[model samples]
Target chain A: MTDHDHDHHHDHSELSELELRVRALETVLTEKGYVEPAALDAIIQAYETKIGPHNGAQVVAKAWTDPAFKKALLDDASKAVGTLGHVGRTGDHLVAVENTPQRHNMVVCTLCSCYPWEMLGLPPVWYKAAPYRTRAVKDPRGVLADFGISLPKETEIRVWDSTAETRFLVLPMRPAGTEGWSEQQLADLVTRDSMIGTGFPKTPGAPS
Target chain B: MNGVHDMGGMDGFGKVEPEPNEPVFHETWEGRVMAMTRAMGAAGAFNIDVSRFYRESLPPTVYMTSSYYKKWFLALQDSLIARGYINDAEVKQGHAAAPAKDLKRGPFKLDDVKRVMTRGSFARAAEAPAKFKPGDRVRAKNINPVTHTRLPRYVRGHVGTIERHHGVHVFPDTAAKDAGEHPTWLYTVVFDGAELWGPDADPTVKVSIDAFEPYLEPA
Candidate 1:
């Protein structure tokens, strides 16, 4: 098949096939009283506004400044995260894997898109796409390179394939030159990819 | 089942495109689909395992081509139809033809949205002592059933070291078939890069998977 043939599958009419199917499913469910339309709005609103990587940044910030919290987080992540009211949905059974100079950690769901929704919000499209799922486990170095990250050959790259219920969160190393930085300032450096182990946290003064 | 969804160690799809400042949902319908799927789960229409099975049940061609939310949309319809909640006519007409079938739980409502969104615990009480512990060597079982299973094909028959015991959790193999939770011990099994891929694999890498007791045997 030509490249044009493959691209044609993604082309859509005025009402895309998926759009029509989703609308139909929602309408029928609403008519049957299985799903409340208002409830759908609530769910959507929460994900869009209330929940996101900012919540995870808070946890990372706390860990960076508080040694006690860091220990608790690294030891029992679910309990530690719950103490901060971040426990919900996919955030259950959370495990925090810390990155040191000698080791790095990355998380993927090879079976499906099993992400820690409560911690980092919804996963990005690339994380769910077939390429990331397929290559992250095999050629992690190449995958890391795609994100413009090149760890030293000495550092070990550990890829966590979330095949079961347990979810993983990467605790990226704290950047240097922030001796007296506040927790909020530290959090501003944490990006979603940093927590996913695809990119490093922004250095001080780097644009977000 | 060895399905297309088990996409570990495979390649040649494309580069990982990172969209800068991507929104939670690219489109309105995607959010609607997400909300509907979550609402049905909250209403106990189906468990996560069963929902996953339906997604895996899609034809390889459709599974490969459909977008993420599209797959969820199709699987949600499949589960709802299988459970008699809605039918082909209802989905096609965009309206219910008959009275609604009572859900396993009540209709997910606005009042309990937060509570429902807080996922319920899948961990169950351990029925017996765990068969494996941290630092123990175990091999992923090679058996592949035509029915639902959580063991990905790539890791099957591969030996790895037990990193941590995650206590007893619902076993997806049986749960997906509506057989029962059949709670079992779960662990984090860490395999070396050379163990999973060949020697050509990046030597500085390792892969870890959350595995149930059923999928492992003492190496």
Candidate 2:
């Protein structure tokens, strides 16, 4: 393979330092025969196209509509999620924390970004940044306020610091007025932040 | 190692600003870095704990300034070199000068992507019985090692209740050092927000963490 360069859009001068370093890293590894470029492409393609939070949305949707699944998910999240065929890296040992009227559950990986990638896909930039990591355990209410969520003062906020292998998924309380909605309809209302405990699922008839 | 990455409770970093409709990857290089890291990991270049140790061991200045993927990229290079798969000269020249070093596994192929993505569990059968159960009061030990560890600095020496018991799992503290897979019992320990912080802490907040058996003791 004569030095592959798919990035033909810009000259060397236009490429940022980080961009060039990434290209160089790949080149060296490929030349060493330690990695296949096709395999890298496949990995990227999987994250970019095949897997994501929508998978979690479907699981959340089913839990909202099915009573048995809701019980099973809260009991053992990894096994319940595996039943739906959503088991993989970063999602091996998942624990689903439910949000109730008396208590709310949120997740933050203060040490490193240990998110459930198989369920929630890649974490957002904010979730991985220093600010959220530092403040979430200290001032979770303030963090939730940044997300425009104002919970009742009496509602206990449970902040889960994902320090070990067990990843947490906040099972947001089902929004009202969707009594007869289908799982797909309910899933559409499930935002990534809602599952992360930063935001709630969209209200019925609200913009997606 | 109590590196800058254990950023819990300390102030001054600024507010959490979420990007609206954030793209999966901020830059093309970021996606490539992620893919390369994953692919190399699949080839058995290094385990996740070792990779994290490299990232955690970065100088405070570099660790604080680098973006998440940038950290991963730098860590991947360091891990590759440290594992003898590549060297600084090859990294700088952007090509291999010497014969490729043998890895524990061969090059990660495209066909292997699917099965690899469906990763296996880290949980192992317990060699001994669990010491505590849900509702048991326990305290996080204050001991800090100079190597890779999952216990954060904030929770050290603090008391919390064991809310749930997860079966034994691979201990990162040993795994990162090329030590044996000494699996141990894990639990979800819950702490009152006021206990973690001072009395000024919000009345509604409670924090929980997954603590391995070694990191905890009977309260």
Candidate number of the best TM-score: 1
lDDT of 1 by residue, A4-77 (tens): 12323445547766677789989999988888899999999999998899888889998999999999999988
| Interface C-alpha RMSD after superposing true interface residues, each candidate, one decimal | 3.4, 6.2
Residue A85 in candidate 2, Cα distance off native in Å: 4.9
Q: DockQ of candidate 1? A: 0.60
Interface RMSD of 2: 6.2
Q: Which ten residues in a row have the lowest lDDT in candidate 2 chain B?
A: B111-120
lDDT score, residue B214, model 1? 90
Candidate 2 error regions (>4 Å)? A1-13, A85-91
Q: Model 1, B1-219: lDDT tens per residue?
A: 999999998879877878888888877888998999999988889999999999999999988987788788889999999899999998999888978988888998998688865666778999999999999999999998988887888899999999998899999999998999999999999999998897887888899999999999999
Q: Candidate 2 docking category?
A: medium
Worst 10 residues of 1 chain A by lDDT: A1-10
TM-score of B-chain for each predicted structure, in order: 0.98, 0.98
